[model samples]
Target chain A: MKPKLVIPLLIGIAFLLSACAGVGFRSDTSWPGLTSDGDTIYMAFNQAVYAINASNGNLRWSYPAEPERDRTYFAPPAVAEDGTLYVGDFTNGIVALNASTGAIEWGPIQLGEGDGRIVGGSTVTGDLLLVPSGDGRLYARDASDGSAVWTFPAEFNEPLEHPIWSAPVVDGERVFFTSMDHNVYAVDLAQGGQLWATRDLGGAIADSPVVVDSKVLAGTFGNELVALDADRGRKAWIFDAGDWIWGSPAVRDGVAYFGDLAGELHAVDIRSGSEIESWKQSLDSRISASLAISEDRIFVAAESGILFARELSTNEEQWKVPSRGTFDGDLHTDPLVLGDTVIVATNGGDPLLCAFDVENGSERWSFTPGGSDKRCRSG
Target chain B: MNIGEIWDILILNPMINALLYIYDFLGPTLGLAGAFGLAIIVFTILIKVISLPLTIKQQHSTQRTQALQKDPEFLKIQKKYKGDRQKLQEEQMKLYKKKGINPLAGCLPVLISFPIIFGLYGAIIRSLADSPSPLLEFSKHIYSSVSSTIIPLDSQFLWMDLGQPERFPIPALESIPIIGDGIPILAIIVVITSYLQTKLTTPPQPGSQGAGMSQMMGIYMPLLIGYFAYTFAAGLALYFVVSNLFAIGQAVLMNRFKSEPEPAGKKKKKAEEQPKESGVLSLLASTQESMMKLLGIPPKSTTQGSNSSESAKDQSEQSGKKKADAKGS
Candidate 1:
């Protein structure tokens, strides 16, 4: 070929390669959004959503059959009582699939005028599915037909300045959501009107606000865990976490347990916004995922791919498991504990899902979509 | 530190903080709706201004190289050492040294520019963190100077989401089957501006080696950049468009002010030889010539001009020979 032609052809090939490798505006690195419906676990990863048998970690079915370019699934699949799975994609598309068969029941419905992306999972509230979008609007869609029922702020023109990257939590008649705009909002679930929005909390909230004891507990990037009046959206109190908290606190009883990006885990009394003494522990890596609580233990997954289970009563490390091999295994998703098996999803790992015995952190099963020899082992 | 860490420290982190700071100031203080986009524009302009000296040096170096390529002595040296690569390089270096030109001077700014550009691209992507993991990673790169309130920079600017590839949806055009979804307006603009910048900066020399390379660049650069604009985030595309426009303006201004003046005799001769076309027709013809030139297609008028210059050279040579003969007699 001519030299001139060769250079352009080379560039064209590079672009093709980069596109094929998913090198775009956003880096293709995210923890799998894992959820369980008791019998089965549904995982939304990079390109497709997979339904695995909760018992043996065997793949039951994957949606779309073939992964579509530009369509990535990251939000956890929200399974309804009737076994209908509602999920959202990075492309602002929401779809309802039959959980048993992985068949699309409704939509691939494009939301937010094809601009906003669905980063957070949808919450199924009776007949309404509340979806927090990257466009900063909490869309309440009809759970049956996927039709738009109402949008938060009610007014179509006014949206929160920043994206809502966390799911909305429903507390009775109101839906509470934390925004990257540094404000937590309470919207009337039925009318989708804003009841109240909290004053700027000094940082962006990237996780769902946990409601316990009539208080909305949220961790912020401002290095503080803030509790607000769940009924009125007023600031209750703030406990400095000393670092940015990326994950929501897993509340058990009146104590809220959470981890910060600085790798410190704290058990705080949600009522007084005071740190529970002797309940703090530090990990080698950052804790970017929400903690999972079982009957006697709380499972914490760190960014270093280490999963540590601590006894709930004494906050002592029960067992620690490190993801095997050199697989860019980073745990940034909240682990789900079902029965005796505690399942953890990894970011950029060979085994997308790893299950361990809740008692001793023994490997139960490892599931990688393409099949891998690696296993999670106790260190 | 690893390469990734080094990159983060040297380029990515600083850029992210810069963008965040700018967004925070512009959005709240100025009350700009598309504050993030404005921040990117301002950032790009600031970078261009900071690197102005380097850019000007590169431009001067390029002009010098072009002038050298046209020099008769340089052409003779090249022909003499056509079969001897090492000798040709040595002679070229000697001539370059004599002319006080650094052949690699033009490449220095370009090499420096690439990192800054890629860093900005990284910054744009990192700053507009849409998902949890990326957002988590982004938080680590934030400097203490940037306020925590500006954690999530608004990615929306006008109709474009700065995070995604840009496309403009025309409702009226939506009925037109193929392009119903949206048109990549930014990508199209990128291509046009890229082509224009490449063409305007490259001195047109038809049939020359430099011309062939320049022509190839003119074709390839736009397509390459256009593809990126179409594929990557709208913010990066916006950067490309703004950067290309800035470069073109700089080149045009430099050409206007720093171009070498023609001799009075030649200028007079050129004026006398000009075709007396009517006003409107001449204006239209001139526009057509300019368009052709901008597209890197040597205009017919320019070819005629080249012919006139060659004739003038021949006449001058003949006159000098005659004077030498008269002195000999």
Candidate 2:
């Protein structure tokens, strides 16, 4: 063959190989975004937001009706008191859909001129819908009309250097959120005025800040779980987890239960930031999602595709179920517990959402949009 | 281990760490703004330097092939063995051996660099972990030496969110009719630089069978790269532009330092005959002339000087032939 043709051929082959390897030029990937309003659970994954019945796992309705190629829905939807679902897409656009009929209520209103994305779910507090954008601004829009109430930075020109991937948690009058800039910010819920921002937590935070007992608790990739004073944003205490923490700790009573990426689940005293005695369990699988706590049991989803239910008091494993025949069975989103069912979303699995019995490790029902032959089964 | 595992261990992991390390080091010094972009530029240059020897070898092989194609003896052999495929192959091989040229030499370095280029592309994608799942995947590949604090490398470079396809918005163009949306400036630059690189590095094939293929390659490569630049992340597109410029510079430098002097007799004969213009140069000139015509500007008369030179050489040739005829009588 001609030597001149070889380089182009090699480039074409390299691109093909890169595509096959799933390491294409566009580098974004996300797990399903799951949220619940007791009776219905809204799941945002790939192209459309799915509303599934919490009781029977039946499809209520999906917004957009047909999937869009350009738009992707991965942020968990924020449901208003009026039964309007407010969700953001990866294209930096927000839309409000009627919960019952899945009709477009207001928008697809674009934010930041399509430069940034909305990775974290929005929050509906009172009449205000707090949307955390990847453009590093937490926007407070009116829940009724999807109109902008106030932007966090105020100055549109000076935005945060990094994206905000964590949802804003509203506590009373103040709302707290985490940014990839390695800081936790507390802003006024009404006017979007910044109250305070914590000094760099030494690593980026990808999960929402949990406001518990006058302390804002957030896990960071800095290998520690930090507790800051809710008002002043001063560091209250830090619990070293031995590895990067990617999920917010499940706070129950006075203890925060969370797992590190190294698969070690620890129960830490939320007041003192000290680990509880003999309250650490190693699952031998990476845990990148927040733990879900019900009455006495805490559900832990591992990257190895196994879901384990452990006693919250003793950190002892009660029952473990392996999500088999799915795409790696990888679970990366926070699990939601509504009554007897604990629901978790998978990363590119056959069934997008799966629900298991909270009492026993049995599969109750699995929900996959656009029904698949190979359903996700637990063993 | 599987191929994927091996690739991650050897290529992807190291590149990821290198990018993180560079970003971390530059964060404090460079003020944390556009540091990741600077790191990418530095990393690309580092890869180019590491593969310099292979690139130089490829350049030398290309130069030798071009010289062999222009050799009078090789042309005579091709003419003599025109109807015989076996004889042509045998003579070509003999001439190649006598000239100490390896026909396959140019391909080996390109083959070796494929993994590096592909690995770099993967590293850029993995490094710019913009979302959750990608960040989780990226976390597993971090080296112990590199700090986890750099979990999310800054994707902001100038007006670009390096993770997204780049566009430069012009507020002034907003009032205009059609192109009110932001211009894809990076993709345009990618096409231009890719074409320039292909033209500069691709040794001028005059009348060889591969000349048309080479010309087609010059057009297709830029379009392919431009398509990727327009659709993919801006970071990868930035890599393409920088790599193309670096390769073009390297080719020019290699050509300057490594070119052998022509024989005096061949030089004089060449001067008396019509100068052989390279396929790439002529194609570029014609393209420029066509664009000029389309824009209603008459092209500068480039052929006038060449035409006068050809006429003077033709008159000198006729005079020499007449003198030779007189001697024969």
Candidate 3:
């Protein structure tokens, strides 16, 4: 080739080779979304669910016994009172695993053609497993046999085509949920009938609504935290966040604590939907996970993989745990508060599920899910 | 670090950070979707302005070569070394050295910009990653200044989702039985602008060695860019359209003011008597040529001699026939 032409062609070839080498670019490697039951910490990472000893972070057992192509878990496992762990996967539908043994109890259940991959953890309310799918439908399956109880929208004559991304908040007999269609839906759990849907909030809602008092408080793409009458779905109040809220607000006492995409953590009066002037704080990192509240402290994980623990009342930072392993990953899963230890994990390269002392943010035990550092990725 | 890691740290990361920085400022006022679309246009303009010097040099380099190809002295040397490919290459180098025109200058910029283009592509992908993992990777590149407005970037921009391939915004239009979302408007713009840019910068060289290659690039480049715009994110297609249009405008403006005239001399006058070559060769393959030069790489053309060789053989034949005809007279 002519040298003039050769230069570009060579660069093109180099790029092609680099692209080919990137075939294994696991940029989406699942982070540890933790679920705790007694002494076992059920950690979901990449493509498998692990049961780790809460004390040492040692692998106890893992579901699927190995990572399957269709079983990558991105959502945290929801543990029920009966020790059945309800978990969602990227490709595989919701699965029910024995919490202690990591054994498949009833599922890998298909939710409408099995392609409606679950990205949100299931809500195990009473006898039904409320699994949210990307297809905008919430599938209610029997917790015992994983049989279909009912699927919202599918039961309706004209099924809504919007994705129900956040896990449905089951309040009493009613399930309050948010959809990418930019509305909050309140439906009767048993009959699968939509009781009411609020007016278009002008933005999509990807975070779950917190049922505080009689209001369903949810954050939205329009950078507004809207409070609606939980029973009638009446719009009560709206607080403009000035940035998209990817993480749902955590309500404590009368204040609603939430972080916006701009890294500003706001404390709003849930009753009035107004920001509390003294309680607002800016962390300067993307916060995409719900705030994990424990006792008097509120645990928040940023997309920077840093976990911040602050006093719930004063909004004063107690301690901040810098990202473990590589700082490239995000802590999408809410930090888990188990007694004195707070567990959190990152989602990118060498994802580390680390446990820190809640009081001082001291590292306790860290675990790597997919690496060959330790055995037992499977149960 | 490996090649992939190196690419991310150096090229992809910087592009992502720069684009996001632009997005962060515009997103708040324009809405997330509009912010991304506007950011791409602004970024394209920034890159164009940064490489403006090379753009002017590429134009000057092309014009000088066009003048050289028509010189009688250059043609005489071409005729002398017509049969010997090696001797022709040596003589061409000497001629180029004497004239002080770098044949590679036209293309060095274009070759250099490829990494930036690839980096921009990677940046777009990373920034639009809505999922947790990819979003996490995107966070590492975020500058502290724009760190807060980084996530949940509104993908919806007007009628298109900046993150996904653009489709018709109107439901009725999109539901048009067979057409299904009509055509991608940005992709169409990319194709037209790309073709115009290619035509303006690489106008068909009638009888040069690069004619076939130039013609091939003219068709393929626009089609390739159009295909990407059709299939990839609307934000990327928007970038393509803006950059191509900017280049077409720049080429027109730069070519209007030619570089300082080559000092006139005896050798230059003798060269003016020769038949002017039809094709004006340029290494302005794409916007990337000058970029490559900025990175300190001179993309030399081996075909410099070959392009002239075909014309050299013809000249030799014509001269031989002229002598025979003179003897007959």
Candidate 4:
């Protein structure tokens, strides 16, 4: 070995190692994932699930109710018919909590050798709980006992790296879901068997598919909104966007309202798969949160923390509300429309729960969960 | 397109896609932790193998330059053109041209391989993103086939969280003295292996000018990598350890091929000609010399008026007798 060889190699290795070191400097806070049932809002932030009052945005009780590193929540909590809230953890497996009391109902269920972490929230149909995991399979578990009912890749395909990321959308007897594996899968809800799979859409589908009318609509990394026949798993039509479509489309009447990764809000004719001429407006930022529709107004939040309220009929901008604080921008959770108020959660750097009036987009109340002061603050 | 966009499409995107494909194929049986860890080793080896021709050329050029430095006449030439750097460079180039050897050939290949290695480091960080925005950017770069196969790669390998720095296995372990839970085991391994690899591969510079600098780098490189390993994810530290060991093995095999075995009598004669020193002191000196060379520092001069001249004479010869006399004085 020569001194010449050693010098250059060391420099190269040093560069490589330095690049690896950058991973540690990243912030620990994660984007918020929220879901609401009636007057209670379930918010998953950092590592815990918080149950907040929907009306004034106040904390009710948080599951675990304390910071714990051994477990972490990545997906928004899903509420079941029996008042059980289901959520996925980044380290620990799926758990069922009492939605009313914030108490553990079933688990830290070890899905696969106590190693699997769920990426999407659980979709409960009847007694079955479908959880999409980083393990490249969707585990169908008994909702009551947290026992495995079935798995998508029963034999486990080692070559296919496709891990389900989107939550499974249940329609009638079939459950439709999209995966990084590039295809939309239609599985039988009762049997947990593959019913039909759409052709690869040339991109990864990270958001859950929405079944609108007779079609299943999904956004993709390919920068297209694809609509497939719900029954046959055939492509109905596709709407091309300027950038990758990450947010799931919200359907109202015959039009689908969604925002792309480019932050442009678009309204498309669901039947014809054409962009509505008057309903397109550029928001000038990236949008990863799904749209929330309430009556004639459609609410959407951007990653920059700007919340927009637009008219459903003309796509006219109704009112714009900036993020609450310097720390309260970078919203990732979908805006939740509860009666006359619209609620949106923030994960820019700080964790905040804010509510605004639907008519004028005025700040009604803002709550910072886990704070000593749990009451809503005036704007 | 902007510079950032161009870089994304060219270096970053390709590397990310390649890594994803490798992870996908290996992940099923190995699990994600095993798959990614193994994939890095394979990718590194692949890069080495692909650049073997260039490496060989670089090796040849360096060896040729070193061999020319040994020429007694080359030393005389340096002594003659001591002060005039321009004439010294001219003479050296003339000599290289006559000998048909390229001094820069060695550097070009290493330079060429740099971007690939750099791009690979970025790809690993971006691809293994545990958050939303980076993942979104990662998604855009991946090919449909590779993207579809793997998303949200499992970062758990053994007890290590590949996405986080390696620490004590449990909180209870922190109570232990000295080697507490805060000590990063993988980082320690990385530092040790890097030091060993550098020590094993560094050829003695002996009287060369860069010897001291090389010795310093031997110590510095390991510490630098150790710091990175301690700070970054365990996955990267794992990559460093494996890559260093592999490099050590490659260096051994390459050196074996480069140098032929001498007869016992010749070896004895060569050993007898070497200067004698106490075993421990000589060993320590040799270690320092190795570090100096690793950092590209030149050694101090022992011969009168001929100290910096050796590096200069490797390029060319003096113009006339007048220039030679001036250098001689």
User: What does DockQ give for each predicted structure?
Assistant: 0.30, 0.29, 0.10, 0.12
Off by over 4 Å in 3: A1-26, A113-116, A155-162, A322-329, A349-351, A370-379, B1-72, B75-102, B108-130, B133-329
Model 3 TM-score, 2 decimals: 0.66
lDDT of 2 by residue, B1-329 (tens): 89989988998889888988888898754676788888899999999999999988888788677766756667779999999999999999998998789888999998998788888888887777677777788788898678877768877799887877888889989877645767889999999989878876786678777887788888887988898888778898899989987986775555434423344675566567756668676445444543343346754664433322224434444654576468556
TM-score of each: 0.86, 0.86, 0.66, 0.67
B164-195: candidate 4 lDDT, tens digit per residue: 67775656666888556566888888888898
lDDT of 1 by residue, A1-379 (tens): 3446759675775665353322243456466888888999999988999999999999999988889998888888899998899989988889999999999999999877635677788899899999888777889999999998998755447777778889899989999999988999999889988899988998999889999999998999899999998878788899999888889999888999999988999999977888988988888788889999999999998888788899997889888886443224778889999999999987867777889999987889989898878766623
* lDDT (tens digit, per residue) of candidate 1 on B211-299: 66667877887988898899878988899899988987776556544624455777677667876667667545544544564655765
Off by over 4 Å in 2: A1-11, A17-21, A25-28, A111-114, A155-157, A323-329, B30-32, B175-178, B261-329
Identify the superior model by TM-score, candidate 2 or candidate 4.
2
Give the per-prediction TM-score of chain B. Answer: 0.80, 0.77, 0.73, 0.73
Off by over 4 Å in 1: A5-29, A104-114, A141-149, A155-157, A323-327, B260-329
Taking the tens digit of each residue's C-alpha lDDT, what string does model 4 give over A326-354?
A: 22457777888889999887763333877
Q: After TM-score superposition, what is the CA distance of residue B34 in candidate 4 from its true location, in Å?
A: 12
Give interface RMSD for all predictions.
4.4, 3.9, 6.7, 6.9
Candidate 4 lDDT (Cα, 0 to 1): 0.73
Number of colliding residue pairs in each model: 0, 0, 18, 28
> What fraction of the native interface does candidate 2 get right in terms of contacts?
0.48
- Look at candidate 4 and tell me the lDDT of residue B145: 57
Name the 10 consecutive residues with the lowest summed lDDT in model 2 chain B: B304-313
